[model samples]
Target: MSHPHPELTTPPPLPENGLRVVALGGLGEIGRNMTVLETKGRLLIVDCGVLFPEDHHPGVDLILPDFSYVQDRLDDVEAIVLTHGHEDHIGAVPYLLRLKGDIPLIGSTLTLALVEAKLKEHRIRPFTLAVREGQRERVGAFDLEFVAVNHSIPDALAVFVRTEAGTLLHTGDFKMDQLPLDGRITDLRAFARLGEEGVDLFLTDSTNADMPGFTTPELEIAPAIDKVFRHAQRRIIVACFSSHVHRVQQVLDAAAKAGRKVAFVGRSMIRNMGIAADLGYLHVPDGILVDIKRLGDLRDDELVLISTGSQGEPMAALSRMANGDHRINVGPGDTVLLASSLIPGNENAVYRVINGLMRLGAAVVHKGNAKVHVSGHASAGELLYCYNIVRPRNVMPVHGEWRHMFANAQLAIQTGVPERNVVLAEDGVVVDLVDGHASITGVVDCGYIYVDGTNIGGTDEALLKDRRILRDEGFITCIVVLDAATGKIASGPEITARGFVESEEIFQQVIPKVERAIEEAVANGVRDDQQLQQVIRRAVGSWVGGKIRRRPMIIPVVLQA
Candidate 1:
């Protein structure tokens, strides 16, 4: 089944009089997320992110937001403010710098450190500015304050943008973690202060709006890992997100308490751990972290392995370990704990890893049987709590899918926000704030841009259409002979097929049928490269469809020479 692409509607020109918020991405998906705030011709972008893999796109590395709308308005973009160091929040920095060189990027120290590392990897440098809690800065006509918020990652912040139109709060992905691993909680007092100050519009994360209750704190998972580690007779391996430095720290501390030495395995996990430790964000005791190469020197019971690929990323250390391709392998009596949930579209890959691990006689624990992993975004109750605390006249749900946004909007209405004030925004929909009231003024051209290797290109309906065709139909190639003088078909048409045919006998039988069709077309005086190619293609398509009950992409190459 094919999903219809949303039509591109041009947003009503920015109101010359009020503040406007536009979400380019992260409104109805998990990645390639970005949001723009325009007040009096100045723009402040919040959380440039990249989307993870999807089902149809098997080998895609990352998907980024199409910045055509903002590309032309780069001068108007005062700053790109980040909320955290998660890939979805900071992954697009390299791409952004590739397009627009050295714009002022602002975030917390940890977040900025990660961004700097990412930029350095790309051989591009940017003007990075660190933002701390309560640090207010002015960019153009907008006065912004970064309020620290707790989540899976440390130093997460929610942006409070004060404009002439009104006060707007853009909550980057956050949760009400009263007992976060970092010991810093989401500031309820600050939220209440903003509410008291009369917030006009609230842009909040809707990633978990459909789920009920507040997300469990990161500290809660430590005990579970400790318990598993203490009782495990053999080695223990934990798979998690590399960017979750706080979670990694928890795992390390738990390993220490269990009297096990930990080893970082995956490339991303190793790189991030080095960064966090160097910056004093993560504290791994000396002699606790040994090189993976030196794992043989330690006892199995004393080894605690922390690696990446919880979502079953093929090349991730955990996945490779499960398949016995990794240098460090888990055998019988080993415990493999998946400390992260299987993100949507990654279930199959994750299950493959699980099956591989089970094949090696290892015990596996996940969200189903263990309290190892918890969401980083607020659930329905927490969403309502944030809504009540912000007390905004307008509530715009960002950073989730259509269902999540709809559920979040419902929560807003349930919390006394008017139904009309609850706006369901898509990629380019712009909501204008006028005199404390908000309305969808116009649409903008906002969509996804796929990054293939180093080439940046559009990921439009046409591209998806081709992908679907290739997936469903396979591919067909036809070679036909034509008279160069008259542009007429003269000889036979040969057909070739792959990824579709089952046996050599069946394919051979189909070839004669195709040749006969070409003969018939030539007898009918079919000529002209364009016309001959079309005739051969249509004939081959019909023949293949009738024989196999499938429509393959028919490529007819007519030779005039």
Candidate 2:
């Protein structure tokens, strides 16, 4: 299999009739999915999305795919074709639109609705085209065909792109859920037909390739959720991804069966579900749905609150409720069902929320203890079936971490795809299709662009390192006053610390070192305030590192008094 190499030079240039495929993100990770296709000097983008921050991200709100690769060529982009409505598939639409609004967005009905609603919040008006399964649209030099696919959400699609160079099929996140809740199964007949028509390159979702079997059908979750509703003695709280309309629908069905009224919590949950209901994707019984404000009027047993934060995002509703920070106090007699799989890197945060809820006398049920959730991506068995059916000339894995992609690549090879035809690449790796063959050509600048509050792409690694130090260690400041005429110490050398467990008296030991260091620097004719501050900083930093073994952020201030 071909792998990205550090030595690979910049791709020479797309051949006159060749198609260039480059992933800006989502090859080695589960989110921040974007891929750029170039043919005839025109660009076609598939899925602009965001990656949620983890512990290491500190103050970051979201991570975007660096758009620098396309900043100069935004006008060349014909349209961004969305495969689904999931956050990881469309969350970054608003940000990308901010760069150059008026770029047309193409997706299914619900997908377009969700993105338009989100874009409305950002005050961006986007031009959009809504297409359904089996529909075809010619945009620029690319002929796009949308095929129905079943996933956790409704109206998911796999795109078939035809260019002069070759035919490529990009399967956005999907599963072969034979009995999807919405009665839409992944269109394998279309895959077989496309295989007969010769798919030159196949880009597949690798998120579940490591799993050994087909993904469990979404229909199976209803029984488990019904059991939870039947056994709960008091109020029920179900936490899931806001965009998971099917799961929310399951919760509604369970609540209706149990004779309970449901209230949607969290702004995202309410907005997304509202859109789904209006679009006919989420069906709610007339009397079973109640406003969150009326939650107080109903008895505990007659209520169900569906909310966000199954991933344990700090600001999400379920997390706030778990930490006793939300108005909806979750305590005794409440059963909180985490109706979603724990995303990688979010285990600790999810566990912390679970522990807090349990400490407050609430019973917690998750995928570990209950069958409340199933993966949205197809597993190894399904991938093998897809490989056998599609039988594409070349295969590339997308939308997963390294291991998942590796596993998917192996599956493709096991199904008779030449080992040489499987391309295993990470984000930023460039692949080109020329003469009916796909190969890695080069790499590009694909870095994480951080979003903090209203700022976009403003925070870099250095800022994150400082934030980590402040959060994990502590902060210390040293103040020294100097005599302008003599270049000598004029007044006190004071040290103060915050976020440290050490007492103020403990810092007294380092104060002497700080004074001596400043005096020595001054005596040596280092009169520059910056130079003097550096000396003091080094002295105090060494003392703290040697004594306390902590590397907190150290600030040194020198003033001529």
Candidate 3:
């Protein structure tokens, strides 16, 4: 059913007796997965995560769900249930914990370990309860059952939450990889079992809902990776997301088979793999792995290097290596295997890193040349199979942008789910289920809260607009020493620029024009600080656009002397 617009819809007084589902993020976005499930004054948050900043969110370290709703009702929240360890699923744990310290975090073992490590980074030691597949845990007014789900990381789980209102199944970021590297496939049998139990609502990941085919099994990539290890006569480096334990497993297996020692580079790659190996999720045969400092001890053909930054992040290990700034460098005989999916929007950066590596005489093998990377989210076929198996009366597609959500809704409709039962949700839409009936009731004030270093929130549109302007056209600041009583210029209306195209000579030529504009604003009796600033801003803006064909941010300062 249609939901009220968030701007118009105030939180419909939490129903007297119904389960209200609201996504603070991850419905209309690709990452930062957070969903709030509420009933009888008790609230449960599923997968508090973060989204990486793109070209648009310049200078933002991470994008998190505005947790004001939960923060406002901290007493109502029972626990935080995490499905996996991926950043998008657990990145905002510290932020959430900071708001309210006592909320218990419940997830699978690997998931808890990663989250614990993150919390430790923030010096936060919150209550963490680790649950396993098939085990049930009761938190507040809900019971949660973790179902084994195969994904990029180990110990990923799909949570089947039971409330007094109904049983809602949330399939966290998952793929039904039949031959997963870890031999732990998604528990479709469990889904079928849950379906038989009568699930009221099924919220599935829609990241790849538009893709037509099933995701290729994770096992398929190891053969190609092994072949690379077998054929490479020089040092071989594989770049991928550090959290891909399965890929790291394959790399370890390949290194062992090829009689080469593996060195983990990059802080994230080392820390995450160490945690995985310690947790028994990653199996590194004795003598097959070596310290990073010892990478130079082995000859080219005797070493296998695994690093992060498959997305071409600037400071990531692979990017640094490409620019010769990394401790480990590759040359003529080396091979750099980019064993990761090129996330959309990362094509440009990834290709730039590839070009740089090629310029360094290193041959790069990636998804383009080989099936080294497969998607971690369910494709259309997998979604259909899940829909048919789960057989929930209501379908709410989560974890995708708007297009993906609509496509997933269409798929749900095609799979015999009533069009009326399929809810197309954005970030703040609340899907309410009562006595096995579902409808989008109202909305919440939820949006993105940017994380910049130690700073949180207040990263508004105006600041972002200023950043964009500064990045694209640079900035021009005019300093005016003014008469205190009269508000008239005392000395100079000087201009300074950082990134604009105006040279010293051009600026000198335009100085008179700028002064005339200011003089005219003054002669016209523009005395109010705001009015004066706007007058100068518009005048300079017009001159810049007309003369230089540029649109720079104009900062006009008026001082009283």
Candidate 4:
């Protein structure tokens, strides 16, 4: 059923000479942060991104935005703007560039470097333009200004956009961290200036809106990490987001202070930190960085391992180490520090890995046990501060789940923005702003484009259902050789089952029953291949569902001989 938008009568088309904001994703979910800004016959994209798969989305590698809305409108797209380097904000660039390889891309220095590296992975070379905070550039019908913001990564930015229709400010994922490691704080002064200039619509990150108080500064973790490093008698393994350069800096500082040589573990952690360090976003002390292969040469107390898989990804280095599959095996007396919060939906996997590490006699410290990690999003108090400073006429919450968006909107209301002015937009809902008034004018097809292995959107709902049935209850296949003209069984009926029966004896006992059902369907005057197959499938499904109390996928194959 279509969600009824009482105010929106028709599909939210691009407004005529008015500004409209369309969330491609990242409204009802935590990741895949994309939005479309349209006005003056020109379109600008903000944050084309992807979502990591949950446990239920088995076999799905990545999920992308349905870029179809912009497919026909590509000519109108002036440039694709990136706010930061996080995967949820930049991961889909390669996918988008696959459609239009020459589209102009804009982002801060570190952000663009990360994007370029990612694009190179897909053999894509796109026209690129770099922008920095306090600088302004004109892109087609929109004037873009980059304002500095503090996040987990360096060189984060918020785009201040001026178009023919109105002035819009998009705050990418940010937090009011006064003591950021890089000394590049979120530009409150710039925000004040934007407020004075008058913002028509304000789009802010809603990831931490429900959490009270401001996010803890990046510097706050140094002491805690220092404590961990000081206490660890053997190797200290730290897991964090690869793109979190500030956190990496802290880990490096702690390791250095503790006289431990640091070796980056995980491919992405090595690559990204190398990029950041070369770009001056990260500072590595002389002789402190060691190659991973040489980690065994150093004494346990002299080594520190920093890796990825802070979210407990199965193949990540930390997980491999916990399972004793990594080259540098960790065991008794080792301390594994998870320097990241548990992302929603990853709790089970993360906890399971943590338990595995503990079972291996390694001490584990995470957010629950230590203040080693801080959220990179603005919390309730920080959002209130942003709302008060920008004082935008219309507020649109972005970059979080539904509850987080709603919570952020309520904060906007508390900051004196009218309840009517706050637009709670989900993925695909279009909010149009005119004369400083914002309303839901339309919506578009904003569905997921899943990436499975080498294919995009390869797993449809039916395929997923079949996979679920195969996983949960196993599957049964029935093959019958039939006489083409007489519609009579010519040879035999063979039944096979997988994941259903444990032993050959049990399977043999079930195969005869399934073969009998196929014969019964054939004798019931089922002639057409399609008809007989359906009948056999249903008969086998019902019989097994009753006998085994399971509903496996019943596949029937009618081969006329």
Candidate 5:
């Protein structure tokens, strides 16, 4: 198997009839999925998306794929083919369009609608082409075909790319659910046909490759959801991904059967479901839907609330309700159902929400306790079936972390794909497909571009480190007045601290240390104000690290008096 090597440098110019595959994101992580496919001097992008910020990423809104590799070549891009409507697959569309607005976006009808809705918020009227399953379109140097794939979201697609160098199949976050709620199973017959036509390289979703068996069908959750709705004594709140149309459909059906009026709570939940219903992907029973404002008119037993934050996003509706910060207070006799799988890295936050809701006397049901959720990605057995059916000459696992991808590669190898043909790569690693074989060529400067509120790509690691320090170790500021003539302290050395439990009296212990450091620095002919500040900073940092055993951010202000 080919792997990224530290010794690898800039890859040689693309060999004749070679397709260079560069992943700007989504190789090492579960989100921020994007890939740049270049051949014949033109690029075809698939699935531009975003990664949600975790607790460690303080104050960050979103994490985007670094477009530096293709920033200069936006004009050379042909079009972007979306695989699905999931945020991890389409959330970054607006950000990418901000760079080059005219890049044509191609996807299924529902997928395009979700993206266009998001793009509308960015005030970008994007150029979009809606295509469904079995449709083919030639975009620049690549011939693309869309295949229907069943996922948590409706109208998800697997893209088949044809070029002079090779044919690459990208299965964007899918599972083979024989009984999907929308009745759209992953088109394995198409996979077999593509295999017969000779697929040179297959890029499959590896999100659940480590799991052992087929994923439970979406239909299997209906009984459980019905049970929840039937047994709830009062107001029922169901939380799921905003884009999960199938789950929402299930919720609506259960609510209607239970004779409860449902209200969409979050802005995204209302928007996406509206789009899905308008586009015929979602089926909302008549008289079952009600406005959130009118929720108060209904009795507790007659009301159902469908909200976002199954993953426990702080600002999301369910989280706010859990924290008692929202208009919908979750309390005694209320039933809160988390109907989505817990996303990796969100366990703590989700558990906290669960505990908070439980503390408020709400009965909480989640994946661990009930069949409320099922994974949308294929497991090892399903991947094996895909590998054998696609029968590609080479395999490159995409859309998963290292373990998931490695397990996927093993599944491919077990299905008769040669071991050496499997390419294991991470974000920024470049792989080139030539003459039916894929190999890692080199790496690119694909780093995380942070989105903090309205600021895109403005937050960096240093700022995040400072935020962590402030959150964890706290910060201390020292104000000192320096005499111009003597280069010594002329007045106060006032110290203040935040985010730590240390007292003002404890800070007094470091006052003399700061004064002595300034005096010694002045005696050594260090008169520069900035230099004096560094001296004071060093003194405070050393004292805090030794006495308090915490390395908080220390700010030293040297003012001339």
Candidate 6:
């Protein structure tokens, strides 16, 4: 399955000067993440991700990195390493498989399981090379070590990359939660050991660098959920990310404390629980897992439904419940809790689901209404704390927007990191590391690939421009017939317009004037295709502008035959 776009005949060449780290994505934004470490003629890619586009982007599903620069050099590329199973970090696997499916993928057992599920869902079966915490592996010229990191999701890690030039610590999303539901905490001693061994360059997450304060512990939400379960007279439904094993444990614990039977609704939630239980990450009490089909037989107060669609994904269980399509409907007596923040650009979809759930007569609780959800990323204070712990010679902030990157860079400076030591990066900008000193080396051909339907192609700025025009003033199509032999008008010129005019009567009054303009263009003896099309376009545009008092996109179909 080849990508729709032309594959790069050659992968990007190694920097002629020294070791360089290139950020393909996750530098300026939250998703579609990728980072490249180039040294000794080898490249190790860390976490390929996809960014979900804004609502106004019609027909676009996601924004991916253009892999043309690395397509030709798939051999020099060692392995695709995953830090966690978040979509922004792993969503590009299918897209990458379509381009070069043979590359080995390395991650922890849980991350591999999630990726396997995603691959099966997409009908892609690529061979995986799974790794666990404390494991060391080699790919090309780079030696990789996986260090367990505490996060909202299971099996999140901070990758330690060793190259001939130096050692780089790529911290994936992490927090310092000592009492996480999973009982796995970040290996700070290991990071401290690495610091003692010496870190040449440090690339860390900056998603919360702008905020101030430590990330709340995951256990804090258990009491809130317990209150909901205890006070609710009817059934209780909790919606969240299916991969958050810690949060899942919290929900199950809360349900058990409230003496309610738990039933998993979404496939993702079920699969993750199965993995967590098998791996001993989740400690669900025996005989508490009830089937969803048996829900009607249970008392309302005894049932606690754990489901998915925290981001308001349309096909997930929560969305189906909101639309009244689920087998169990939330009546006036049920209490529904949204246990996650709406990912940016998904606000509209989240709001729609909320509206639908409210219409179904269920009480809804979210971040603002209740303390049901907390962010996984570190806040400003936590970011400063991590900076103080590592105390790298040079700091590169990745995984945030431009503003976030800048703010985080400032925070790094404030946290005793010298101003010169902080480097704010964007996609394709290469920061060269020479003997523990860093500087901008050069740029790479890094940009976004828009996925629209089955076709993956470069998003044209012109198309967006035309879409903006259509959004503002609508569109009008003008068809004109000109005599090929004598360059004269032959038949009646027709104007077909939609979304611009309210009624056919308005179009009828506007058509003749449009025809007269076309006749004038023919009378002026325009013969060339470009000239004729331009003339017709301008004439129709002017007429529509005068009538509607707006400039509609005028598409001219000129026929000579």
Best model number under lDDT = 2
True-structure lDDT of candidate 5: 0.92
Candidate 2 at residue 417, lDDT?
A: 93
Candidate 5, residues 392-488, lDDT tens digits: the string is: 9999999988999999999999999999999999898889999888999888898999999889888999999999999999899999998877777
CA shift of 59, model 5, Å? 0.6
Span of ten consecutive residues with least summed lDDT in model 3: 1-10
Clashes of each: 7, 0, 0, 2, 0, 7
Report the CA-based lDDT of candidate 6 relative to the real structure.
Answer: 0.79
Q: Write the per-residue lDDT of candidate 1 for residues 1-561, one digit (tens) a residue.
A: 011135635566666778988887887787778888887888889889898867676446788887887888888888899999999888998887787876899999889988888898889888988989989998888899889888888788998989877889988888988887778888878998999998888888888989987788777787787778877889999899998887788888888887889988888888888988988889887779898889899999999988899999877888888888978767899999898876767889999999999899999988889898988889888888888887888888888888888888889989899887777877887788887788776677776688766667745557676777888778888887767775545665666776675753565566666666666776787755687678778777777778788887888888876
Error of 2 at 301 (Å): 0.6
Off by over 4 Å in 3: 1-8, 482-490, 528-530
The sequence of per-residue lDDT tens digits that candidate 6 reaches over residues 1-561 is 001123323234545545778788887777989987888877788998889876566657788987876788777877889999888999888888776677788998878787877888778887788887788988878888889898888789999888878788999988777677677888888887777777777788887777677888887887788777778888889898887777778878888877889999888789878877887778898778899889888999898898998777777899999998888787888888889877766888988988899898888888878788777887888777777777777888889887777877888788787777777767877677877777665577887788877778756656766777888778887676778897766764677777764764576676666566656766786577677778777776676677678887888777886
What is the per-residue lDDT of model 3 for residues 119-181, given as tens digits with 9 covering 90 to 100?
Answer: 898889889898989999888899999999989888999999898889999999999998887
Candidate 5 collision pairs: none
lDDT of 2 by residue, 40-150 (tens): 999999999999999999999999998998999999999999999988889999999988999999999999999999999999988999999999999989999999999
Q: TM-score of each candidate?
A: 0.94, 0.99, 0.95, 0.95, 0.99, 0.89
User: What would the TM-score be for candidate 2 when compared with the true structure?
Assistant: 0.99
lDDT of each: 0.82, 0.93, 0.86, 0.86, 0.92, 0.79
Winner of 1 and 2 under TM-score: 2
lDDT (10s digit) by residue, model 4, range 433-475: 8877888877788788889889897678787777778888888
For candidate 1, the C-alpha RMSD (Å) to the true structure equals 2.9
* Alpha carbon deviation, residue 222, candidate 1 (Å): 2.4
> Where is model 1 more than 4 Å wrong at Cα?
1-9, 458-472, 483-492, 523-525
Where model 6 places Cα greater than 4 Å from the true spot, the runs are 1-17, 121-127, 290-302, 320-331, 458-461, 464-473, 483-490, 528-531, 546-551
C-alpha root-mean-square deviation, each candidate: 2.9, 1.0, 1.9, 2.3, 0.9, 4.7
Which pairs of residues have clashing backbones in candidate 3? none
